[model samples]
Target: MSGAHGRRERPPAPEPLPAPTVDAHTHLDACGCEDAADVVAAMDRAAAVGVTRAVTIADDLAAARWAVQAAHWDERVTAAVALHPTRTAAVPEEWFAEIERLAGDPRVVAVGETGLDYYWDHSPPAAQQEWFRRHIDLAKRIGKPLMIHDRDAHEDVLRILREEGPPETVVFHCFSGDAAMARECAAAGYVLSFAGPVTFRNARDLQEAAVVVPEEQLLVETDAPFLTPHPHRGRANEPYCLPWTVRGLAALRGVTDERLATSARRNAERIFGLADVPPAAHPWTGGTDGARSA
Candidate 1:
């Protein structure tokens, strides 16, 4: 059904998982959420369906600030701050300083959604690389996981990570590589976060790669407000829809949904330092769908 202003409504929520997991990457701000209450409702929606924890990511300076605030708004939410590659065309030195400041916050768990994006020509390649290096350094300095967003620039992203000496915990968010690339990343001790696209019928290569990834290195995400999973591909995505991706991945890997979800949750907790976070109350009566359009 259409929402207000004739926007496409979100798909109905998938069934809750047998075990809880974390959305390693998402953007609550992009989901049209703007305040603490909105963030809480979104978290509750996700929590209701066993996505008990989440790490919302920032794609630009404004988002970086918003992410940290969102983290504070809900204990279930954590933040990853960065200036996205596509937005690096004209970034000033001060912007990096601000990102550094945000990264220092206790609420910020990772430094990223950073790396190369060759798909969009919005930013010059040189500038994207320059800032990518800066974010890498910041992640290393802060002793946090480095979350990377590698679009059509896989070679360069890998090369730079090798050259710079990646952080102890590196993650390729929404990993888009095939089996060969997945092996390379796994061998390097980097985590591969698979988002909704893995469930698409045309994504045989991704499914193949997902099978090759070690259970400990695998993670699942919604990339909410985008990349809605199969059977709901064209609709607005939200965290509650994450179970579809998890179930699809579990089937591909020939594991029980509980086992896959457990491993993914452990990997996220270990990487993002969420090991100490207490579980949110599981009030199953809430809307299975995520926060609705206002």
Candidate 2:
């Protein structure tokens, strides 16, 4: 149902997946989660649909702190801290220190949602590039994966990564590229995380790109509170909506949903070290419907 201003209502939860999956990138804080209980309820909904774990991204200092707290509060949630390229324009240089401090937490699994966002000119290109390099350095020094957010500046992003030498593992969150770019990233061994847009009927280029990604390097995300997948596009989104995206991607890749979910789960675990994390005692850990992950 449409609500005020005709904003589409949240879609009903889809059928649970055939196997466990992980929301490789998201923003629980943006999904209207205000406290531990909200976080728990969000994860509970995700767990119901076989999304066993999630990496909540922080785009600013405040979000970074909240992300870490969420990670520690609910074992199923993990954090990625950074200043989004758009936000980098106005934030003080000193704020980055807070991001760095938060990044060191064991609960924080990655350093990103950073990188260039040329599409939004909120930040001058120079400032965005400068901070992108700094975030890269932070990831390298701390030995965590660097999650990128390249928009309309893929070549520059790659060039900078090569210039500074990329961290051991790098991920392109909400990867928006065609087949050729996919090949370039795959060749460089950078993980590509497809989000809800992959389910859009008009996203032929992205669909083609998704098919070409090395199975091992492929990932899926919600990027929720935005980019809600097809049949429900323009609607509100959350981790629970991941099934539609996963199912769509699986179809494009010529695989069963279970196979894709299993792959995404394994890839996310390896990249984020989610396997070692234990969920809250009372909640379902990694499971399909009510069944636990093995």
Candidate 3:
């Protein structure tokens, strides 16, 4: 029998699987994987593990473009654009305009992954502060949420947020500070997002922070391609591993996994404008189980 074009060439790579929980934060550009294809495959793996949504952040224009394009390929994925604290000095004046342009795109849901990182000091403190303020302003002007990244610069970050008066939805992604800081952020009505480090034995302070954060203001993330949890420690982190972080937070808060997971999902949807996210179902009972019994 004759065949059309040698058997239709095997139908390209199947679309990547979808995730169960929303990963609120991640850096697809930093996974150290070879290229976009590798990153997409990683995301697919994450989806298979139940990570239903993810916010892929970019620290610069090129990376932001990559994030935007990545979202185009996956419905559950979205993008966040801004100059990271360390890279702030290198950004051109027109970068703000570019960010504004990107923010207007529906896929670009948040204004940052931006804030202070005094721990590294990769850029001058002043430059980092200036850029951070710019991102906050941009977020406000665009009426979108802001994803903040603070490291050893909490005082200034808080001060700036107060002075600038951040928009309604603000998120502290990869929140690693003490309980006091968590309380302060929560008091200000900002969402606190925990990452893989929350599962570490030595992360007692982070555990404390997790316990005290209000349920409605709490979130969980992978921060992947980095901060892999304990069992997978030192390995390249990925979104599929978010359950470890979520379980860790649940243990810390003395709440059932179902309660913690539902709270985290609700918080993520509220802050990220993803209210359309369906209720999470327990794996064992399939869809009939609904959320885990509290």
Which residue ranges in model 2 land beyond 4 Å of their true spot?
1-8, 277-294
Model 2 lDDT per residue over 1-294, tens place? 112312437799999999999998988877877667677888999999899889999988888877887787678889899999998777776798789988988888899889998888899999999999999999999999999999999889999999999999999999999999999999999999999999999999999999999999999999987899988998888899999999999999999999999999999999988766555333333332321111
- lDDT per model vs. reference: 0.87, 0.87, 0.75
Tens digits of per-residue lDDT, candidate 1, 125-242, equal 9999999999889989989999999999999999999999999999999999999999999999999999999999999988999999998898899988789899899888888889
| Candidate 3 segments exceeding 4 Å error | 1-19, 32-40, 275-294
Q: Give the clashing pairs for model 2.
A: none
> Candidate 3, residues 18-86: lDDT per residue as tens digits?
324678888765664334444456666776666777888887777776676656555667789888898
TM-score of each: 0.92, 0.92, 0.84
Top-down TM-score ranking = 1, 2, 3
10 residues in a row with least lDDT, candidate 1 = 279-288
Clashes of each: 0, 0, 8
Report clash pairs, candidate 3.
18-47, 19-47, 19-50, 19-51, 19-52, 20-50, 20-51, 20-52
